[model samples]
Target: MMFEGFLFVIHLFLHTYCQLQVVAQCFINLLRWWRVNKWNADIFLNQTKNLGKIPGHVSLMFLEEDTPVEDIVKPIVWCICLGVTTISLYDYYGRLRSKKLDIDKELREYYSDFTKNCRNSPKNQPSPRIQFVSVENGRTDLVYAARDIAQDLLNGVVKEVTKVNYQNYHKVFRNDHPDLMMKFGIHTTLAGYPPWPVHLTEIISLPTCHMISPYNFLDCLNRYFKIEKRVGK
Candidate 1:
């Protein structure tokens, strides 16, 4: 009985110590977040000059359900303002996919502010394109691509199996694979994002995205540009 009591006391102490450590880490993270100043298009424009390269196609993956549409749209607008040509907004489920019109409406509103505040004319920027990709879309794209390839083969359109490459598949979908994927979640796993497209994509995991500030967005971009991709070397 005494030995059991002593073991219980040790367990209690360890649990309390772990809880305190978690709290201390949270406090440190909060302090770091507070130190990052909010940025705008003007700041982004300046930062772009210093950046080595910008991702032409970027994907924002939201793992959490019920994420506010504004939270999703704000980053898209920022990406546009920063001159990303294409953007993909992905959620684990198809909830956001059905809300495409709503997201577009919100994007336009946010974009107007970016144009107004930015020194460079919006006309000078490449027209930004966006897609709402869900888990279903990933599966559907693969299945449909296979079906199409099979049909084309039967019709003698595709001469060789080797011809059915990623380029052809991507052309069928009319979407470019993401160059950089930003996953907004505390969870480590990607929650089963389409494997084929992101084979060579750069992925950065972030905390649960609420109102994503420009500082956080630009910080991700900075991290992406810093990576040295030694492909097949």
Candidate 2:
């Protein structure tokens, strides 16, 4: 009975310590966000550039299905301003994917406002290419790829399963693999993001964000560069 009581006390202490750590980290993150928010988009990009290499393709995953379309646009615009060419937005379910058009329109408006206020010349900015991905996209692509592979095997196009290469799957899902994936919530579960594409991607998670604050977005990108991706090494 005494041993079990001691174990319970230890667990309580550990849990309390963890909660305090979380609170301290949250406070630090808030301060960083405040500082980053003061800078213009161009300035933030310039400062972050010195951190390391910028990602050409970025994936933003919102754990919540009901995340507002406007909130989704903020990060997309931030990616554009940071000179990221390809941006993918994802949610667990297909809810956000269904509103792709609305998000696209909002992105245009949001980016337009950003550009107008931006100190950088319009010609210097690169237009962002946005893709909305959901679990359904992955499911469909997997099904298509499997069917193709099966047909190839039956028709002697592919002799063995071991002979199938990345190219076979790439042909079915033509989207560029993301260089960096950022999750906008504390939840660690990927919530059904396509696994194949992100095998080598650097993923960073931030606290739950209802709106894409400038600091959190920029910090996430900065963190991406600092990570050493030693995949399968």
Candidate 3:
């Protein structure tokens, strides 16, 4: 009985000792982290490199800290004043040179003051609306495509062109009027095909083996008649 009692006391002391050692290690690790994090705050605040200059054109919202109101206001003011000032200056000069309005020193000064007022006025910046036109919606491109479709038809004006020259027509057409080209359908492969266009496959393959190249030669398409003229004349 005495030996058993003695073993129990020794086991209790070893368990308590192990638990205390674990707690002490935990406190040491906690203390190290606390010091590291505290020092990191100071290191970040003093790091004055890329933080000062923002990337790209100014976006309203991305920043590490609350941005100074002045930073946002200044560029907006510059852009607004510069835009109005340029228009006003152009008008003022144009009127003077064209003799449309009698230009006096007072009028020039008044124009400058008006531009200044427009910049300093702070009514929340309005969003600029942008409108876009696509190649499929352009005027000149549509008209050019229409003209080309009829060019080989009826008139017999220019040499009948092969489908391979589609892009060639498009390039020249766009160069003359690019703004309208973007509004019309620039590319359409099967759009203008006639009901009998598939039969042109036979003419293209010669022996009607398969696949057509260069141009579809449907017998029904009047354009095919030009093949003889094109080869000879």
> Compared to the true structure, candidate 3 yields what TM-score?
0.19
Task: Point out where model 1 deviates above 4 Å.
Answer: 1-39, 164-166, 170-175
Report backbone clashes per prediction. 0, 0, 10
Task: For residues 1-233, write the lDDT of model 1, one tens digit per residue.
Answer: 99999999999999999999999989966764553234556766776777877788898999887887767887787778667898887877768878988888987776676566557645577687777777766677778778888888899987766633634764222547688999998888867677777877899988977757777887888889888764535
Position 113, candidate 3: lDDT: 36
List the lowest-lDDT window of 10 residues for candidate 1.
Answer: 166-175
Measured by TM-score, how close is model 1 to the native structure?
Answer: 0.76
TM-score winner between 1 and 2, please give it: 1
Best by TM-score: 1
User: Pick by lDDT: which candidate is best?
Assistant: 1
Give the distance in Å from residue 203's predicted Cα in candidate 1 to where it truly belongs.
0.7
TM-score of 2: 0.71
TM-score of each: 0.76, 0.71, 0.19
Model 2, total clashes: 0
Clashing pairs in 1: none
Q: Which model, 1 or 2, shows the larger lDDT?
A: 1
